[model samples]
Target: MMRSGPTPDAGDLPFELPRTTPRERARASALARALASAYPDAHCELAYSSPHELLVATILSAQATDVGVNKATPALFARFPTPAAYARATPGEIEPYIKSIGLYRNKAKAIHAAMKDIVERFDGRVPGTMHDLLTLRGVARKTANVVLGNAFGVHVGFVVDTHVQRLATRFGLVAPGASITMIERRLMALFPREEWCILSHRLIWHGRRACKARGAGCADHPVCREFGSACELRISAPSRATGGAPARAKPAALKRSAPRRS
Candidate 1:
């Protein structure tokens, strides 16, 4: 899947990006603008008071909802206000507060280990750089991008969560069947560097509110019509696979004036 795609530039470093046409990039810009106007105040939904708290919440957010994470974090953050505090407690000590979240045991372990790493390796401060952030337990490119962009104001890369991944293709911003890695690069190539963080926020809001994966009724929404006609064309849109890339529905599925309702 990682066919050498121009060794991605510094804008999207650490991964490869398939070459894009100027027209495609323009469409992406238009989409970003539409989302900006539609969701002017979009932001990271995860609640946190500090960089280390954000890092811990993000780790707990894997395969979990922000609502669930937020519900758990208030008490947890109040209890262990700093990485040094978390470092002193065992994972078991952190579990009760987060027990409401899915996979609480594992998340507690990851949070404890990551905090210990920060205290020992990074001097009790959350590492701001992507490379250093990834060294933490339970961190990957997505979590690293989240912490870097939101916590540190360093937009080195785009965050490719479920919403971003789905909305990217539904808006026709990337090639059909593109991998998540590829979708992220295509987005990087298309949008301005500074827009990466807030753009993700707005797009995620759109996905959740209008262009939902199930029972969506926004086919005629102005933004969807102008930027994401594919969102309405569910028959031809990408399946909810790993990358959220469209599957290119069979020709038989395209013979319709109105999309079939779910």
Candidate 2:
């Protein structure tokens, strides 16, 4: 049986505690390998050529799909190709390009303001460090992590978006209702620092293509087949023909326990 103890609430723990046991680390490593093989070309779906473009795209991606962002960015980038151009343009001018995306007004305002900051403070270059990147409008930890990882190849932290959160929970890497920060901490502990960035992409790919939120396609996926039974949310295999839940089977006796707080 898995070990147990009187663990404190997740809120009580430090935001970043790299403290996974040997078995958990091994499991995480294996999961990463399987995902890498399954999705060989998994990468940041946002299309961008420069760091500035990526920063803008990441900001726009908030509460929006990457496909949506990509659809909007071609014209948006054409109009405001450089940080100085974005800084100079008014939000009203920017809004027309990204209007199809959700919260375009607010995102345009943030993009305008962030570019102005880049122009004035960083001399038109997108800041590479998390500290400097966080100062920009609408640039949260998730956005910063995206830019740092993909644009600059810096693995300061992992990106924990909705997909990452759901997949991590489904993989039994974290408990249900765990905060994004706690989930990120658990992932950081489980995987090596270098794999942090790409790991998020792989999880996202799996989440989007297979382990969907409403009806997960978990029947034949290697990682899901191996790990699905222990999922905190109890992901069920879906029927191939109907895309509905398969008929229930007798529950297997629990073997590996759900992850416990250390």
Candidate 3:
């Protein structure tokens, strides 16, 4: 199901938010504050030495894993180490190395265009500001967040990827169906600006390792303590103990139930 109602910005369709009460907002904020202290070591996993590399790495990371992207980027960077280099290369040349990533064609196009723009406008350097990066192809809020926080040490906004979005809803920090922008806005109202970058990274790590969509480990999780009333464990205990039948059928009991009518 989607989030409850229209957001503060109600111009869009499908209504991107649930109507959060003031009290609920306070509780969510408090929980976020506590979680910040709980997970302080959060950071982006992608490896990159320069701003341009981080930009390209984040773009390639779409629909792909950091480990896989990392494997491909070393050779990719060796060949096209800067925006100028990438801007000059043909898509055919880049595609062979990046073909393993999903949506390689689209990613290649985005990378080529973004590099060309960077070289032409920024003098072969990736821009640090959000507005500037947004102009680059394939640089959505998520990718911009990764580069801003990780590359420039600028925590302009929270990174609300699949993990962040899923865990936020499950933790009651957000309602359902909130857009990434809406979720980030709500979270930003609560978390300190200094911790936004690390918080996103930690949340992503936790979501990947513990709070997975399929089989979350919520029962004994340290973060489970502040889960409030709504957070539910993805795993459940055996049903037999809860006013249900025993696991095994006894042979003697089964035999006694048979009738021996002549």
Candidate 4:
């Protein structure tokens, strides 16, 4: 069943998110300003000229770096330039191009199946809406958020990648241990609806460069000084902010799954 009519700025938000207090919104606003100032030009790093290319790149990006996905994608894109092109090929043909990426075999299947479905159902165009996009084989809420925000200019939800999740907890934008679904809704409630797209990019930018998951890269920055509580969380409760590092950081809560036709 497609999500009909108005879609909330929280990915149809499968879970109920707690409402934000005015104080929480004020703090979140300040953090948003700090991020925007720091990363004024933040944007999706996955290089693509079209929506379908972006979709495939984001799929391959699971457990793979954007750089790695970019490297593999040039040849792949040149070969299968459109949904029709990929739809014509078997998953085996798609495999060779993306073989260097993690889980190539499975990704090949996802890409092939998704593209084939697009051709058969969506008139070979990448469907821009969340419900339609989620029906594609490889897409989940996060991947859909990337495609929706960056490709289609539809910011229906916040993206919660590892960097975003870690930084959110560290910055106190979210408490430790919120599920990804809940975190997306919480961020949505805190930020202005129009800011959702750039907001995620900015968070990712700062997450990569400054307020890293392990520890602060440079604690002197004002945002970190005010919001950088992960260090304290680690000191007091090892499992909270740090995910008890020295051991492995907990694997991200999201996984690529067949979408719920709910």
The best candidate by TM-score is 1
Tens digits of per-residue lDDT for model 1, 98-200: 9988889998999999999999999999999999998998788898999999989998788988767666656666545577777787677667778889998
What overall lDDT goes with each candidate model?
0.74, 0.76, 0.68, 0.74
Measured against the true structure, the TM-scores of the candidates, in listed sequence, are 0.84, 0.82, 0.75, 0.82
Better of 2 and 3 by lDDT: 2
Please provide, for model 3 over 135-177, each residue's C-alpha lDDT reduced to its tens digit, 9 standing for 90 to 100: 9876897888889998899877778887787666666555445
Using lDDT, give the best candidate's number. 2
The residue-by-residue lDDT of candidate 4 on 34-149, one tens digit each, is 87888889999999999999999988998787888989999999999999999999999999999999899999999999999899999999999999999998889999999999
Ten residues in sequence with the least summed lDDT for candidate 3 = 253-262
Query: Model 1 Cα RMSD, Å?
Result: 6.0
Q: What's the lDDT of the predicted structure labeled candidate 3?
A: 0.68
Alpha-carbon shift of residue 98 in model 4 (angstroms): 1.2
If both were scored by TM-score, which would come out higher, candidate 1 or candidate 3?
1
Instruction: Answer with 1 or 4, whichever has the higher TM-score.
Output: 1
Candidate 2 per-residue lDDT over residues 1-262, each given as its tens digit: 3332111233333353634455566677898999999998999999999999999999888888899999999999999999999988999999999999999999999999999999999989999998999998778888999999999998777899887877776676765566787678777767777898999999998877876664335656777777653322433343222112121222332333332110
